[model samples]
Target: MPDITHSIDIVIPSYRLEKDYILRIIRLSKPEKWVFKYYIVVDNPNVIVDEEIARLAASGDITLLINPVNLGASTSRNKGLEAGSGEWILFLDDDIKADERLLHNYVHAITKWPDEIGFIGLVKLPPPPTAFARALIINGSMMIFGIAEEAESFAWGATANTMVKREAVGAIRFSTDYPKSGGGEDVDFFLNVRDSNGGKDYKTLKEAVVYHPWWNEGRPSFKRSFRYGVGNSYLGQFLPKYTYYDFPNTPEALFLMLLAFPIVIFIAPVYLGSWGQLFIGFGLVEVIATLFQAAKRKAPLSAAVAYYVVRLKLAYETGLLWGNIARFRFAGIGARFEYKGRKHGNGFFQFNTYKIVKWVLYALFIYGVFL
Candidate 1:
């Protein structure tokens, strides 16, 4: 780390967090050579804090703000940010503690990266051991809480363990206009920053890692994954930033999925005159590739495990379908208005004149050709 000197306000918005988790974060966040202040905003004031944690609050080592009502992380975080006075505000999840040198990496990255960089993303270390956790990790989605890989110009990052330049984040705040249960306000909050802030990007300090106690909470892991899938539609619905993360774990997988739907229909007749043998070839290659991917995993995977992973994948799909329907139930009505994005056909509700034609072609190609 360079000889950099800047104050950081560690903001934690808590809701029913464990005492041990709270203490661990409070301890690990206090870097030896750094000037930092810690603020823990209790979303529900009635949620009891242990004696040691309360003492720390009384001693001024940590500041505790109480929200009269439980407004969830997004709203509580905004309150913490408002109270924090520092050059940088490091937003951390109440349940997660950081790497020993996490703060150092964030400070170093801020000093090192270009000024256009608005925030530094941190890696969420391998989650706790559980069947659901393992499945969620293996069946990955970019929207999974506190997940980041590779230091790139990626704008979306979990606020669970990230540092943001306080000045760069002007009027932008986590959107409380979303569902209390459906998440993505954290990810969308930063994406909105990139959109309005002269195209500012966020980078990862890969070593700035935190341990997540995955699937330890009361909510079933599958339910959480499903909720995340629904929550994802809110990104495109509100901000117009296409932060829609795909359900397929990889780009190849995504392409194969899209291709499979049509390509399978394109085949399935006599292999000669009407149907494509090419589709069969593609399917064989895809199966081999998928098996190869599963084999390459560090842990030996079994057939049962693979099936469970497939189930998790479907959970995401279901969530996306349900979420979009719920979010855009009135989109057709909104399309009629002469608004910023609607009137000129640039909006999401554009009249796709060729839409039905494309589907009709698929239907005709499938039945007329195959049968």
Candidate 2:
């Protein structure tokens, strides 16, 4: 049996919120005994706690750490970890609501594991959305974990809904160098842990269940897309093994059949029926691959089709953009682990002049190659 005496601390980094909602979730989803503390790191110190929070303030189980400025997620989380007093830390996004049994399940699951495990989290999904809410989910990523098993590998998406043993994270901190709050921080953290101890000891755990909050919003602008591209570009350098494993054929495979498909009726094509055939075949392959993944997840078929179209185009365009600007700089937010005296750098890159040039080249590349 695993040791049960060590304490667990749950850290929630929040911005502005309706205190009542936060209170409701905590009261309804009571945690287990191993949990020694609950810490909420807020951007504003003057923000009022909900009535219930004030009532429970004297219990000594909860602590609120106030920050003078919005230091972004990576920094704020590190601050929480510093103030926390437990052997294990549970990190939760502010917007999420726990399943009634989430905290208990986490305690049960984690206690069964060995000390070397680096991280763990519950299964999660985007909350059901109204038609209006669907808009917001467009560019947002959703995380869902399956049955409890030792993770064979590690990845960035795991951070949004997971737990990390205090010792595993004792030496690695979140990277602040990321241009934006939501960019490459997770990837940097995961890579650091994997590379630590000479890459011989890195582990992740997923045994509990949790839900991710989702809301419909607007489509991403070009600026947002480019920033995301730059973040991935930076991550590509660190975890060269896993960054772009999904795309094997790249520009070659996509460009070969582009113009030949739709122009078969009118324009004089050079390749006769070959390019047209490849275009249809590859397009079908793309659609099938995407739809299969979506179906397995029980996502709507129509939405799957739309997602395939949008994502394929975006991938092709972004690939060309990255190919052009092959440079990355570590200049943005950097996170420091106060207790551990460790830090990680999130890289930053400019998105102005190159952004326009990238789109135009991508458009031309698509037009000339695909038609």
Candidate 3:
């Protein structure tokens, strides 16, 4: 029971993804009392959409645009923005399953929240059999909805599911410089628009939501994890907020794992704490992390979740190292650990919650490097 006065225009960018997803999203997205226009931009050059989709566009059911070249999601989204003519523009990934009231919630949220700022909605992924993905969704990614703060200079709204006033975005567009997938394009575009008009910013809308099938098929492979790592590199190169979160922070980490792990294990018994104090201290971190996330989500704990989570962590870290190599090849990029005189991240805790230690260590390195 919320306001239903505003209309919605949706922009969905598709690469090599399936065509049915777009239709499914459109089907579930209709809301009561609000008009919605759909735009599906195909990024692939060779593959044409089925005749039905083209006919739908012709019949005014959807607006379809085909890219002559595969310019990536960010670019296609910009095109979608240009094609749209509504008061607000909604961005949705191809894989999402919209709630029956998803559009309704968004309209309600826009009425409730500040009109000048953009809004990032919630994304729910189906529970996966792998521990890594579950851990990722719960600990590392979009699951947490703490509190919202004003961030005009920098915003990190994910493009997967978000709403923004057309007037607020104005002429601002996504940056084309980052890797097509890995760069912080979502944040870049939102913050650019936010910062343009006298620092109007973005807020989180916890009620406007959708579900994704990210982990439903199976666990992601190491190659996929590596690509994510590579994308993380682009973020470090493009966004100051993720500087410490990227590969430039990894040399010492690699050094420690390769050289110090065995030494630490050997010395644990040799230096022999007369009490179990040392082991207790080491065990405390894992216990705390597990409890913190579980307490928030109230999710059931199990052995399987534990196993894949560990694997996923290592896979991404290794990708950071490899990502550095990839970055070097494309264009020489280096990590600037310290961002003291610069702004970073959307809000204070809009960073990796699981690796506070890595962030701290990287901060020290950045400071020491500058000195």
Candidate 4:
């Protein structure tokens, strides 16, 4: 029986409104020193409402809003925001497994730092169950929320677990321009809040933890990555200052060029005879070098992992290229965009030895692939 000083609205947008999952979250959330309300927005209008969920809604334990038609996650979140009447709005994903202390920690942080506009909670991934999951973890695909956990303050955090002040989010809504599959809307929403408040005051609260399961059952999925890339194209349109031409710089761009090199040799054999073969040989050597390094590191599945990594990376970039083409931004077909507001650490050299070595290898690989 702690004194309640503030109110929080926990907003979750879900397409698959799982009753037991939502009930688990509600049961685990301990709003020790604050009053909180759950706002569940169902994005799929066709989803049948659960009897228990409807009963909870009727009992006022939660506010359930079923969309009249299918809407994207962003629009669903906007609907939740419109319905809530709390001082803080905590955005969460329906799939996440909430920690028992999730709401309690947030309430403590909010009380301790009343002036802060937002706080990002830590979203952790369970141990990788498969080789592909391990690869994704190592390659940084599964570490999006983990990265924010290491930071004291960050530019944007995934809506999977984040709390924002209602005043700071006044009139700011998640962008509906992204693809229906969802991608850049979370980033766009936070960036908009940051811009409106004119500060990077969102602090990271590592104590509030949530677990997000890997998609596709810990297996590799190109479609999900490709959709993310397509969604990223909208970021460039919304925030052009961070976007730049990616040609001749990124490994993805270099890989595309390498794939097109044979056409160049075939078209102009006289101009590029043996040189083309030599160039391709160098690329082969780069691949061999990578494998050798992996062997030295004692990673048995390095070859398979590397193959999947390159394949997924290419898929993402291709989707980005197609997205740019769809938007008629021909010049930005090979564009590089950095929507993540701030970077942790001082410079590349300041990174730990492992990171430095990884970056050096990447640079060498890029150079070799470009030739």
Candidate 5:
């Protein structure tokens, strides 16, 4: 007989309101030592709730809240949080499939780390069904949750499979400043929680796993990537101390600048002359060097994937640049942020390498133009 001193409210905000997925979570076996309640916030007001889901709600198995209007994800989550009274809150995406041991593992972790105010679970991805999906994995875009699987502690974790103690998260709700389509709200929320809790990082629990399906049937979606970029750009303003501006720190920025070389040469060939060839050559080198690094890292790479990667990178960076422009931060075009004191997980290597390459390219360009 396990102790029942605490309760957990599982909060899910969904526009799709997939009945089967919701049922699967409701049907998951409850943890012995913890009580559970389901709080499903329907972001779509027009969609009819499934009969089975309605019945569950009527029977008290699930508390369903239908928004009168389309209130995006962050606001929907806040609505769910307001209705729940559990000591801990477990947030899950409507599309995710939870493991049988999901609740059990969280309970065990709670017991083991009583002082922890939050916990991050592993988000496992199913094997890619297409080469494009595989490329996403290889490029690290599909593995956004992979960090939680490896790191023992992290600055923040995705809400798709994260749990937090209610007391520690007091007054710290997901920020609506991000794009309504969704992006950096999760990081902002968790980072705020950490800050409010005296800098206590969230604990990562590999045993708690949820499988997330690839978006758009595993095909590349530049729109989604662009939106994510736009959302992430706001993080710098939301948390300035952890983020800073730099020149050409991102592959997207480098690729974009490199792409501009041809246009510049085309518009004013007289001014650049043969010097434009050097810029073009440098761009080619950048592409080839990236491919080489990918291959060296054992990442899946092919002509098709290379093309997709470039297109996606360009789309994301363009959105990021647009975001910076929207915020009127023209001076901080290439902003970067640190995670656990490291920039993008491998700060020292990635930051310095990009910096050196960018400056070298600039020096060469200057030399060709002037000398």
Candidate 6:
């Protein structure tokens, strides 16, 4: 390694977690001498500090700041940015295992494209997801698009694995209007960065990578799942104005009319005449569109379902849009529902029968196209 000054600082915003993970990152990343200091921002008061915190503090290389109340990741990170004294401040999720090469990759990338890049994010490769995790990843729809070889013209979104120049941090402070805890802060910050600096773009370096834990600590329950659905909708408050033109299609309403071309094409030649073949051609176009959406997520062939998948996709997106409208219209004081580890049994809602009936109705609706 060339002679580099120890001016870089790394901050990890942590809620409650097993201390071993934090210690592992610090110990593993010890060889990287470019780091000047490490800060762990803790929002929970009861979280027990271990020997690693003590060691870091003793070495004068690490410090801990505990907030009086539980703040969300956005606020916690902003506080870290404010307290931190360094030229560049890097953010890492507490759960991640920071590899030896992590710091060097970030430093090298920042130096090479220093002016063009506003924020540098490590390419996050989450491990093989669990059944629940897979369902959520597939259904939740937060994945990125485009191939590495082609370098498609799209935004490479920011994740927990990101670094920012400290001076640039003030321009894009996280939005406080969002629900204090979950969802949308990362997207909001990156979008803020885009708008604030006159037309400057952020770039993603493929070599700068980090490994993220694959799944939730345990299987997510139905209620937890429902809350996630609702929270995703809450994100529209900040992001709606920007209008994520993620796909190339007519407006969603017009797109549905276009969806009919494939069915028209399939039935045209045998039943009608050469004119029907034109309809079939249009149908092929829709299939290509659906494939484009799936490819954006890096969706796998093994995960593919029968033809009814399109209905489910429409339902999820429509549900999200309606959920956001409902929340905004009816939101009042204390509108938020906080989930702690508590068990409540309400028999009016049934799970097993619900899935069966829902899928059956969806299949019938899709099958109606042929009828």
TM-score attained by model 3? 0.68
The 10-residue segment of model 1 with minimum total lDDT is 332-341
RMSD of each: 9.3, 10.5, 8.5, 4.8, 3.9, 13.0
Clashes of 4: 0
Which scores greater on lDDT, model 4 or model 6? Answer: 4
Quote the lDDT for 267 in model 1. Answer: 72
> Considering every candidate listed, which one attains the maximal lDDT?
5
What's the lDDT for all of these models?
Answer: 0.61, 0.53, 0.62, 0.75, 0.79, 0.54
> Whose TM-score is greatest here?
5
TM-score to true structure, per model: 0.70, 0.61, 0.68, 0.82, 0.87, 0.63
Global lDDT of model 5: 0.79
Over 4 Å off, model 5: 1-4, 249-286, 341-371
Expressed as tens digits, the lDDT of each residue in 1-371 for candidate 4 is: 77777898999999999887788887775765677889999988799888988899999999999999888888899999989889999999999899888888888898799889899889998887767776665545555588565778877887999999999999989888888778778888898898789856589999988999878788877887778778887887787655655323234444555677788778865646444544455445445444454455565565668776555655666677767767877666556666566432321223333334445665675565455
lDDT of 4: 0.75
Worst 10 residues of 4 by lDDT: 343-352
Model 3 is weakest, by summed lDDT over 10 consecutive residues, at 145-154
Off by over 4 Å in 3: 1-7, 16-19, 28-35, 142-154, 197-201, 241-252, 255-304, 329-371
Per-residue lDDT of 125-218 in model 3, one digit per residue for the tens?
6655566566665545433222222222225466788788888888788878757755446656765676666565466766667777764466
Cα deviation of 66, candidate 6, in Å: 1.4
Off by over 4 Å in 2: 1-4, 28-35, 44-48, 54-59, 126-140, 143-157, 197-207, 217-230, 238-371
* Cα misplacement distance, residue 22 of candidate 5 (Å): 0.9
Candidate 4 to truth, TM: 0.82
In angstroms, the error of model 4 at 302 is 2.8
Residues 89-168, model 5: lDDT tens digits: 99999999999989999999998998998998999888887777776776666554876767888878888899999999
